[model samples]
Target: MNEQEFLASYDPRAYPAVAVTVDVVALTIREGALHLLLIRRGEPPFAGHWALPGGFVRPDEDLITGARRELAEETGLGGERLHRIHLEQLGSYGDPDRDPRMRIVSVAHLAFAPDLPDAAAGSDADEAGWLPVTALPGRQLAFDHARVIDDGVERARSKLEYTPLATRFLAPEFTITELRAVYETVWGQPLHAGNFHRKVLSVPGFVESTGASTERGGARGGPRAKLYRAGDARLLHPALLRPAREEAVR
Candidate 1:
């Protein structure tokens, strides 16, 4: 058919309507616990319910751009802070009835940042803050957000096993003890200190020594601990599997 005939025959409204959105599952460790960033919804469908920071994707923006834009809008994190955050596509969630208003599909993104400041609510959110993941069980999360948070948490837990992503949740330089705490907190279990230390050091390029020690002694008054920074390894050779995984399987 000719171009003019094809154009005239097509009907834009023939197909079912659908909308796309982006949601960010921003996770961080605060006070030795795992926390997820959330915003209180200000609009109906589920107004007042806490949810992952997100919004409808703008026609002019791509998925990742939309995700970052929604994050910045809800958290007020921009420039250096925003650029420093590690973001990745988590998954796409679009259960037929997930959205009450319409057939909406959301592309969720996962983010990790060193302890961040409180979030500032945007135009569509009533308030924004980081809430402990442990406290999410009984909470009323808007839409299918609770499931989204679960997926993000599982991704974080699994990534820490084979990737150096745990460092993304820590300061530039940290002690081995502090690094171990990141694992323990995210895994929601205790790790043997001696075993963890040995395994970490054995993983070449996992961390590098700075030839410096903390000015103060240990919290209980031992010799000063050595300081180290993230190394160049993209993946852990001998992945540090969570100790509780076997138990959970059983």
Candidate 2:
């Protein structure tokens, strides 16, 4: 068939309806533990169940925009706080039976934000808050969201080894100990303090000193530590591979 003839014959309505959605796996450290943003569904198909904050993509919106809108809406975050968050596409999940309401293809986005205040529930969510990642094992999460969260956590853990993305989980100026705690919390294991300190400083452009020190000493009362901010480098040279990964490969 000619191009014009083929176009005329096409019928979009003949195909089964499918919906696209965007879910955000927002992570941060609270009380020295890693937490994920979750919402209680206020509507049907799993009402009252906790799930990652998300919504169906609007017809006029792109995937990233849709994800950002959902994030802001569910968390009620805006202005400088909203702009400070770092977001990136994690992956897409589409199982024919993933959603009972219909066939849904979810483009999941991962976000890292500094410690935020209690979330204000949005229109679609009855309640919104940060849930500790370690506590998710026994809880019920709606619509295959548990799996999505697992993937996002793994992505965050892996990304930290080779990227400066971890800094997103902290304030603009942070101490090395604070940064190290971020790694420990996300990785779910304790990292060697001395080794971590050396590795972080050895990596060129990983962090830049702020030339200012904390007003007080360490939490235990020692000389104050110097502060630093995220540097310009996008990737780490001589990547700091996780110790567990090294053991597995050996």
Candidate 3:
């Protein structure tokens, strides 16, 4: 058959229908705890239920763009406000019955941001806010969002072992104490301050000393803490391993 003839005969309806969506597991450290951005549905299919910020993607929109748009919409945050947040594709969920309506595949994204201001709900959400991940176990979640959040949390924990992404949850300049807190918060375990400081300093591109100290001293009224900024290295050569994982290998 000629190419033009084949094109003319093509019918998209011949096959089963499928839709694509983008769900973001946005994470941030607030008050020494890891929080996730959740929105309460104002419409059906899960009315009044809490879920990650996301929606069906526009036909012409890219995955990452759709993820960002949905996040901005549901959280009522502007693009500039979300610019510093690191967003990456976590994984794709496509179970046959994952969505009650048709076969919809969701590409989930994991985002890391600093402590942002309070959020206002968007059109599809009745309410929007950051909720601690630890507090979600008792709350009812919609769709496969529970598993998605689990994967997102694990992804963040594992990345901290090899990447400098934890710093994404901090300001432009921070003390090692603050950096350690981010790790401990995401990993849900205490990291030895001395060991963590040493490892961070030894890494080639982990951080660069800013040569400035905080204006205030420690809680105990000690010397001001030194400040450092994230460095040029994209990957840490000697990856920082969690204390338990570090011990298990030895």
RMSD of 3: 1.3
What is the TM-score of each predicted model, taking all chains together?
0.93, 0.94, 0.96
Question: Residue 150 lDDT in model 2?
Answer: 89
lDDT of 2 at 49: 92
Question: What digit string (tens of lDDT, one per residue) describes model 3 on residues 60-156?
Answer: 8999989989878765677577766798999999999988989999999999989666777888889899999999998789999999999999999
Give per-model CA RMSD: 2.1, 1.7, 1.3
lDDT winner among the candidates?
1
Off by over 4 Å in 2: 1-9
Q: Write the per-residue lDDT of candidate 1 for residues 58-140, one digit (tens) a residue.
A: 99999988988988886778887888899999999999899988999999999999868788998888888989999998678
Residue 203, candidate 3: C-alpha displacement in angstroms: 1.1
Residue 9 lDDT (model 1):
100
Backbone-clash count (model 2): 0
Checking candidate 1 for backbone clashes, the offending pairs are none
lDDT of each: 0.91, 0.90, 0.91
lDDT for residue 165 in candidate 1, whole number 0-100 = 95
Indicate whether candidate 1 or candidate 3 has the larger lDDT. 1
